[model samples]
Target: MLAQTALAGATSFRPLRFSDDGTFQISIFKDLHFGKSKDLVSYNNDRNSITVLNTILNAESPDLVVLNGDLITGENGFLENATVYIDQIIGPLVDRGLTWASMYGNHDHQYNLSAEALLEREQSYANARTQRMVSGHDAGVSNYYLPVYGSDGSSDPKLLLWFFDSRGGNYFRELDKSGNIVPQPNWYNKTIPLLAFVHIPTNASLAAQTVVGIDANSKPGINNNVPLAQQGQGWCEDGTNSNDCAYGGQDIPFIKALVKTPGVLGVFSGHDHGNTWCYKWDSELQLPGVGGGNGLNLCFGQHSGYGGYGSWIRGSRQLLLSEEALGRGELDTWIRLESGDVVGSVSLNGTYGEDLYPATPNDMTHS
Candidate 1:
């Protein structure tokens, strides 16, 4: 029972619900860096990225699609061509009559390009579910949530999907007087489950990699040859040594707020183009005062675009949530490569980190 409202010739999505089979599936396409330029090479890359998206969407038929972040390379765009990428990026979803939501990534902000412009373009499509701040609100653009209702037609929502704009790159017009941004309000019910989507990986996310290494035989996923560009950390090239960068603790407040929140099943991030794996956030990560052993999983979506700086085979991460499994806070996720093969299949539960999963094959490995 998909609900929609007509708004000036465009349909507005409302009240997302699970299927009659009591299941909901979400496909995440992260780092789809489109619109780098109008050159032939860039055009071909964008087309291939779209083909990958179409393949996965047709194969999975997911209930929702998430453009996780870095949807465009803002620095490569101008005011005239910046937002036109939104149409090409969302074309597949619209063609299929599927709905979607997005978060702004580091590269999404630039002197000429902005998250506000992107959101405005996205909202023009009836199936686009991306949201922005109201008149009096001052949070970053794309910081919002959508509720998912159960198949049983109840007024109350069964799950919530939260989207946060990490806010990076050169665009910095909107800011609070205090220079601090609160991603969301405290209006959610603690009893209901929720999942978070943000572009930049938190500091804790890098910590999990050391605890859960990418050993193909056991823990699976590609390892970025370069150091992870975490939140509050500059690019690897900006470091003093230029070879090794240091992590700044500026993102601590956001991490603390996220871990302290209740009913967060998992947090998904995309910034590092070569890293993709999920690990539990436990006391070993060293966020003092923040509860760490709460069965929360920090996962990364596979690099899904050709425009980013990576040779990794493009693919999208798929999450399957069952209405029956929600009570136990269980979720199953895996990466679906462009070749149509599934890898890194793991169930995010109590024993997630210790769990074994298939590794990325040699042919699909990131160079």
Candidate 2:
């Protein structure tokens, strides 16, 4: 088992565990894009985003909530007001007495706003479980893990949750003085079932969408409108060519690590606002060096905020992990919209991609 490090100076944290019924549910709100401005339009959009959060929280009552990224648009943020957006975005979760973890998005790094400032603000709340596990490290502030114990009250954890900081934004603080961007080491044992969350999707995710073709009718999700913007936008793997269609490939190492790791059920990401579908990474479409899809599934969280670009009705992705299901290497997930409708429900198991789901509810027509 990996060493469980408590947040420095943290007073108390709500322990995460399955219920008596052996189930733990998580709701993921991605790309909230709050605090663009204090204008009436931006204010209303932020308000609507909060409403979506509240609606889904009341509906799913998930054991943990994940603010996947882009909690604020840092370009419009000033030093005096940048971190305040974190307070507003987390208000809904705190009001419901919910615990949450946050990941920093590409838009979150700016002159005034940063992952450090944002994490500090989030950690100020007693209910916020966001942690900087490796202090004084440049791996970004949100890199940490949480253990979910079994319902029977044993000390051993039945499930492990991993969070990564797909550091983005204008600032390049993640790089060390040597200019090397350190990759996170494989830290968990293969025995426990693990789930990972990040803000920006990796190259594997983009490759999956490209190969599968993002169509709601065929893929079992809503709003396949925009193309996925990966972690590194320009520059190819060779690190020479700019404007290469092959992508920056900086995230290749991360993707390779995940694909090779065992017990990784699925990787959940939030960045492509218009795309929200889960695709089993096909071995045939694996990138240049990354081998074996290994039954790892790639999923996008619903765009839960009104501040972002997309017009899709706001919603959050819900995940239900049961002890019995974990024994069978299976997971259940879906999108819970603000309208109180459930869509894109499916099981992530051996036969995941082949499984049929209820037709995605009409999202474009509603909003």
Candidate 3:
């Protein structure tokens, strides 16, 4: 009886729910870039971000909310203020009794707070999916999977949700005895609308640009080697030139997992604030000799926070998964601006002609 009581008393994770129509809705906001700097402009920007977040939350009324990355700016060097930013961003979700999740970005650790510390703060929220389960790798925290079960409360999951920490650039540590400071090895590299949230893009992200069909916006200011057109409106900074980006260099295995996972409709990230393009990446693209195979949809969430640097209009990405679409191995997603305009959209599985994939909103790619 004592042992049974102990087991029964343990807390359990609440499985994600779907709407009455057997469809699930998710609103993903990235690069919130929220900061609490003491200045008129900074204060106003933070307020605007909060208002936009609330507006999107009320407008879409999604089943789940994902605050992708760069959720907060840390240039102020104030660690205590971190919680303040999280509270402001998560307030809408709490009020509506909605479940949400988050990931850290490259700038998130600017104020000396590590990603692990940030995750600890987010775990305090009752509805957050940030359980502190160790990922057993050097990738740090923000590595876990959430299963979206059927609305009937079945044990079998209908869809899988993945979150990865692309980590901020490496900070310099003290030198070793041999007059050299060997940096720690990069560990985490990995994501999907089958969806992921990461702060930095991987080398695979850079390679995907060459193959995607989307007419991505151009940014001439970027200085990366991939050329201005391939930059996709923002710089595609991967781990190739930067040693602090990810572990095991390019993290090809991580990217391959996203391709191998079944029922994965897309993978979303938020690092390049100005880039918001979605395209397909097959195994052949990752490994030239592999040939063509089912690929994963790679997408970048629109910049939603005012704290970051970017001249583009800010918005969030919304994904709709209907039971019929899921049965047909398809999902629908689009970018919804704070002004309530649908920028671009696509059908995940490529099977068009249904009410899900309207011609007006953009379609990512058919696999």
Q: Worst 10-residue stretch by lDDT in candidate 2?
A: 1-10
RMSD of each: 6.1, 6.1, 8.3
Clashing pairs in 2: 106-168, 106-169
Tens digits of lDDT, candidate 1, 38-130: 788889888888888988887897889999989998778876777768877887787777899998887787666767788888887888899
Candidate closer to the true structure by TM-score (higher is better), 1 or 3: 1
Over 4 Å off in model 2, which ranges? Answer: 1-12, 135-138, 172-193, 215-218, 223-226, 236-246, 365-367
> 10-93, model 2: which lDDT tens digit per residue?
345557999999999999999889986779989888888888887888888899999888889877886677777777777777
| Candidate 1 deviant stretches above 4 angstroms | 1-12, 134-138, 172-193, 211-218, 235-245, 288-291, 362-367
Q: What are the runs in model 3 whose C-alpha is more than 4 Å off?
A: 1-13, 36-38, 135-137, 171-195, 211-213, 216-249, 283-293, 351-367
* CA lDDT, candidate 2, residue 90: 74
Clashes (candidate 1) = 0
Q: Give the TM-score of candidate 3.
A: 0.77
Per-prediction TM-score:
0.85, 0.87, 0.77
Once model 3 is optimally superposed onto the true structure by TM-score, how far is the C-alpha of residue 139 displaced, in angstroms? 2.4
As a whole number from 0 to 100, the lDDT of residue 35 in candidate 1 is 80
Q: State, as a TM-score between 0 and 1, how close model 1 is to the true structure.
A: 0.85
Please give the range of 10 consecutive residues that has the lowest summed lDDT in model 3: 227-236
